[model samples]
Target: MDKHIWEEFVELERNPKQIERCEKNAEYRSMQTIRHTLGRCSYSNKQYKLDEESNVKVVPKATTDKWLMGHQRPDGSVHPSAIEAHKKVLEAKEKNKGKGLSSDDHLVSPELEEVFPCKRKDIIRGYSSTMSKKQCEMAAVASAALQNRDTDHEERMQAIESTMGIVVGKMASFQTLLGMLGGKVDSVIQMMIANAAAQGPISTPSPEKGSTTYPAGVHSRVMETEDSAPCTLDVGQPVQLLDNVGKVVALGSIVAGVTVHGRKVKPNERKVYIEQVYDQKALVWDAPQGDGYVVLSQLSLPTWLIWAEDRLVGLLNS
Candidate 1:
């Protein structure tokens, strides 16, 4: 054949296993399909028609359709039964069949009864089995008043809802809900930026001489003296380690030595290794990590500070 065809043949021979692997995969898939079919064949199954008796406990199509049509009946009921709704549809179908009106069934609405109307006999027979003539007339008039005169059957119902103020242009839909949320998110981001700008630049504190960098997992606790106490009325332990008292926000392998507030701590008696910090809520000093040594903070810390997963989940679930 052509030179290109010969080259393709040579390339195919170079990868003979490719076609074999593909065929093997296809065969494996077909075997799986047959297995599934045989498994299903081993079981007997039956499908039943869900009839009107089931309608008593279950929602009906008419009720669903009425809700979709913006009709909230008294007692917040939906269509009474699927059979009734189906009958109405069939009546409408038969009335419009083999006639000039059939060509424009799409053109008629409850609102356009005065202009391009569906037969009054069909309307009465289609719905309102228990309603009086006067009641039917009133309903037809109400429907016409709600719908647009020029709109089709589908548009007519929507127009009716629009006329009654059931839905507005500003109303949210599934597709637009994300965009609305995004707008709120954008506003929040802008507020944060503005607040940060108003605060001006942040300055870093210089470490004192001869101070060692605080290791990530290391913390130093200084107990309050009698004069430095927030309140001396209710007394407890004088020297308390914050980490041992409070929760542990993060737990990870130690990596390097750094103070809780990002200060460089010099290596002293403290073990140094890089690890994740709880947060920048408090000051952490370089301290030796040994048995019974834990980082703790004051109870007056921000409520957002959470130490443990259980505590966080409990707060959120509650």
Candidate 2:
């Protein structure tokens, strides 16, 4: 019996197809071996043979369980499911052994490091294990390049923020300086007007006829048809004597005995009037007041102001 079993095993080893089948499907190989052993059984000097015409013959239910028991491990234990799983894993390994990294492997190539910097060390190690020295060097170069790019990006952002802060500070300081100069100019203009009035209508040279030209020192100029026409101030127009701008809420002649009001005004200390009603006399101007009436002539719009109302509106809408 031992000699017969050894002969069968030798025959199976010689047959390359049977060996392949055994590796691919161990349960089928075991069943084939049992069927071959059963074919060799003799009763009354006659061999008891199974049907050789059919590749898939139905075995007795009792014998099926014994044949399908699967191979035993070194510990002399059999688990068909675990065996099948292990066979599948080995098959997968053999299929991918000689070939390069598969898409499912998710191996980080040197080129991919630029875009996908976060690569698992386990994956990297697996890839590197099979790589040549040149390939490893390339991967190292790619990693260094990615790190340098990140560092440069961080540095560039920091530089941009610092530059922006400096620019903003300078702009604020420039605006403050302009406001101070504007206040001084307003005082000088008031003093000049007062001196001119005291000189009793001294003949001042008239500007060119039909010319819409403005003086160089003035920020804005608006020509009116009549000198006595009530000057209209618009919202967001900066007052010449005040530090901040004003918005016009209402328009009308001030009624007699009706006191004008302001944020920084003292009781009966300030007054507002139009040239047509106030006998062409100007009043003393004060600074740092909020939301008050002012003649249009006393307002000045800067020719080169940044972050203007129109720009702000467009930016907000965009």
Candidate 3:
């Protein structure tokens, strides 16, 4: 399924020229468009440069990076910071499942690592089977709330099994997304090559049509590579994707290399465009009774558009 989705994405990028034009439009030159084209936070590298005062390489550490082998919560959500810890814990769990724990297993599941007041380590040690069973029963009770097609209690049991299968399938899909992450890097690298090609020969001085030639000792500047550089994304690498916290809505491919028709302020400052990658608003929870609602136009992040390669843009959910 991952391969199928990625292949479809790749097919979309076959025409880079068209994508370039879309990316360069004035409406698309907004911060929102740039974010989508790069498929990550629109300003992470910008912020880094502001603080450091150095030329920072803007890498596309977007959704693909997050989807890979990162630390996933029990509910199957990945947090950028917790990815490493999650990976270690998941490794331990996989290693020790059904098999007795060994001393080496301690590396992944460290002793006394507690996020909640309760001892998660003790739970893994089987010292809290009663609590575990209680939790499972609670989950079963909660699962009953899910709308299922099955009406009969017996049929509902089958529905629960089917739902669990779906959850497992989604987890598998996230894993597969990570494996296919390498192509993003390839696309960026190829774009750089294309940029190099765009830099053609410099014109020499002609006698009648041009000015006089300089002396032989005069220094001549040699033509180098293009100003734009490419940064590739790695699989399973967790980078903060959005300037603001908002769910990803839509994704599309872009072709905003130097030769493409993107808005170029200077030679290097070209912006990419992302279409349909945001919700009408950002979703958040507030107090009083703690209700969750979408605040329209309050979304801080722009939609995700893959500017160079087959990038996936997060779109507004409207």
Report the lDDT tens digits of candidate 3 across residue range 1-318.
Answer: 575998877777666875776666534334220011223523344334333542432221222112222223334465454455446545654555547644332431232132213555544311122223223222222222221112356687888999999999999999898779878978989999887678643443433322223323221321112221124333322121221222233322233344322222233222233343344542322211112224424332433222222121222222
lDDT of 2 at 296: 35
RMSD of each: 23.4, 29.1, 37.5
lDDT at position 219, candidate 3: 13
In the range 167-234, model 1's lDDT, one tens digit per residue, is 55546464488776888889999999998778653321222211223332232222212332221112
Model 1 spans > 4 angstroms off? 1-175, 204-318
Q: Each model's number of backbone clashes?
A: 24, 0, 20
Relative to the true structure, candidate 3 reaches a TM of: 0.13
Q: In terms of TM-score, which candidate is strongest?
A: 2
Instruction: Write model 2 residue lDDT over 224-292, tens digit each, in one string.
Output: 222321233233332122112221211122222222332332443322222221111222234322233
lDDT of 2: 0.34
Regions of candidate 3 where Cα sits further than 4 Å from its true position: 1-88, 97-133, 140-318
Model 3 RMSD in Å is 37.5
